[model samples]
Target: MPHSNSKCWDFCAPVAGILFALAFAPFDYSFFALLALAFLFACWQDISAKRAAMRGYLFGLGSFGSGVSWVYISMHDFGGAGALGSSLLTGLFAGFLALFPALAGYLSVKITPINNGALRFILMPVVWILVEYLRGYWVLNGFPWFQIAYSQLETPLAGYIPVCGVYGTGFIAALSASIAVEIFQIAARCDISLLSHYSYRTSLREVHRDGPLKNLPPLIMLLAVLWGAGDLLRNTAWTYPIGEPIRAAMIQGNIAQDQKWRPENKINTLLKYKRMTEQYWDSNVIIWPETAIPAYLDQVNDTFLVPLGNDAKQHKTDLIVSVPVHDADPDKKYNAAITIGKEEGMYRKIHLLPFGEYLPLQPLSGFVLDMVNIKLGNFTPGVINQPLLKAGGYPFVTLICYEDAFGELSAQGLPDAAYLVNVTNDGWFGDSIEPYQHMQMARMRAIETGRFLLRSTNTGMTGIVSPNGEIIAQAPLFQETALTGTIIPMGGMTPYARWGDRPVIGGAVILLLGLIGYRRFFRMAY
Candidate 1:
């Protein structure tokens, strides 16, 4: 049978994961993230690789199960998946994500000795972050939500965002947690006498006599210094303002998902947006939410869009709006955003949302979705390296919907694209924390690119984010409102925008390989 202490950690691991979710938006208990990871690190220490993997799996199951529970809302409330099917699918999805953390735990232990300090302090963080990068970027076309760095946006770790990006910041956060755990573990070893004596006085005396407590202060100080450095760097600006500030407005139509696409509601939707936008025509730029027009480009071009474009040009304002586009090939319709007035351009979405925009795994995904009564779009992805869309006589990157979640994709036009614009329809998730979480990730893009981000969304979280990841202005959820703000076009690039994730990911790869080589060499010498 396992020791009582080990059993206790096993019970606490899942609980810790639940607390970890609270560190993100809608709760904003940021420090809870550090405490939760430290608890997880404690559970993995001195454990067999298999046992560590199981604990990690449990933690992951709890983390994603609570963090992304909104998936059930989107599937059942909107996609028509019945309660039973949606619940099961959500569980299975969380379980699949859990495997990544399990892999991190297994690799951390397998690659280093269980008793080695490096196992807790070095290898653990490296393996954990690398696994996150893999799961966030590669698998299933990427689901980067719940990444730890997004939770640290308001913390000192945010200072590192413009320099190394989200993955690097996450690596530092995990490393900090591991180091704190190591200190606590050392203190625990020193106070082992208390377990037998049942005396608090004896434990204090023993802990001091063991001499580990003397070194504890220095380790604690070192952690403080790291945080201090981040705090100091927070004032550093990586990008500078270019031209004069322009007045911008984001129109949140707050359309009901159930009624948005109805033929009878189409004209009403267009007129509604037109009326709302007419109020902000004095602004230099006006944006409409994703698919606010409720019809294809060809359907509205002649009677509706042309007149709107003419009016925008007459007012000396640029209008950006989203509506589906019909290509010459009937099967190649795209979720696209277009600019009218001042300058004209089009950008089709490059990254399609898995399941929401298109089905994955073909027959299997289609079969399961059909059985669940879930229906989704069959949209096509646009070509890469497309030209930046121009608005108000300046170039900007266009990210339709969740494209802002992918930092690298958002940075592709950077150092050239003056700013970032994201148009999203968040009505599918309906009053859930998903919109808040989405807004959080989108703000990180502004930090990464060192540019103002204009986000227009349907049914909530339409806002403006400044270069340092601060929310400049935000509309209330499920409200029909227009958020107006000013954006200064930024002219330079942050290190993150210039190099992307290469430096941090490369360092991790090299460090892991070096550790493996060192271990093999010592084993052969012995």
Candidate 2:
């Protein structure tokens, strides 16, 4: 049994340590790479399930608490909430985010054969990955923000993204951590009895038959294969060139969230977008950020619509603009994008941001509403099978604001959309890296679907990404500007687009079930 101070430290240290690591969560220098190592160190002392869970939860709380602290900025700065309210809300969100890692830790210990060091090491990666995957899409509409795979955007490992999505990169990262831990355990063994008791069967044989160097070959080869394959895939041209290039213009009107809803600022916002659009009128297609029009579609009189529609038709161009729509359904409102041109239509956003768009806890929502200064409460979800809009003979799916962050949601609605058009108001988060992170998530979606992703954000990170997750063109942050580029919409699907995360989750379930069954029925011992 551990002492009180030791127990307290054990309980709290992992969380604090993880939080510290996440303080450097930008994509700069592989910060998460080091954080993963630290996590292994924190878990090294105790190999039990309970300890693992506690540590994992702490780690998760720290990682998410720090990395996503930007949420507090939005709530406090823009959500019309006071400091205390924002802090409380932030804590609640972070706590909820921490649950995924808690699950990972608990399940890893339960499934792993701790005494068999090799098996424990092998299974830890699988357990970690499965848990992360679950967090990405399971409970409460799934929040996959700040996934470890996001940090690998600039790394060679990113090549695997087109084939397996970000989740697979996470698996590889976790596996690398496991290997490092295994080495640490092996080095720390002091006695033959301890070695015999804790070492893996393979390790024991390797020690006795061959030297320590014998196992090194497999480890080196495994890493070499992962890195080598990733490099090879990175250089490979997985996407075929389209016969013709589609010229598009992305307008980044730097609208402030505070002034967005005010009646006085409405005209200013409209003019800003219109002026930017005029510059790009020659492009094949022009796009505006999310909720570019502050007023509902019905509320915007023909004065605004007629001229914009005429301009699009006269320019021989299609305009994809985001606007709030209030249909005949008096009770609901939708965030939607309408394409105005020869083939005019609309695509409503299916997945809405939980707290930002729709509050989950209705009773508590009222309390939050009273506390916060924001006027609106809920935005309705669109139908599951919403089709891609056709404009200028190009088929494309439109994702509003944070909707592009979700890999499955982006892929499911339109499998055959020539490409993706993501419209967002990242101005809510200001000049933070939140916009960059959001764009990174959008790139993953492009890779998953093997399509060109054209993201237009109000406060920069507006860019065009290729099918394999490379940024072809990007505007500087916090700049009110417009970028005109030619995007080749790729046809056909990557493995991730065809199946999505189901295969990964299904594989995990099978492995876990098979392990449970073998343990229960056959009484297999490691």
User: Residue by residue across 1-526, what tens digits does model 2's lDDT show?
Assistant: 2331266645665555454445333444555553564454336344667776677677767777767778888887887788988888789888888777777777766765545455556666677677777777766677777676776766777778767777877777667666665554444443455445445745655563444434555766686788788878777665565447989999988778888889989888888888878887778899888888999898773878667888889889999888989878899888899988556788878888877788777778767767766545588998887767876467887788887877777677445678888999887787676876788788878877778889988877899998877899999887788988998866766777777777776776777776656545534543
Query: Per-residue CA lDDT of candidate 1, range 355-448, in tens?
Result: 9889889989999999999989999999999999988667999999989999999999988989999999889888788898999999999999
lDDT of 2: 0.73
Clash counts per candidate, in order, are 0, 3
Report residue 56 deviation for candidate 2 (angstroms): 1.3
Model 2 scores a TM of 0.89
Distance from true position, residue 152, model 2, in Å? 1.5
- For candidate 1, the TM-score is 0.94
Question: Could you say which candidate leads in lDDT?
Answer: 1
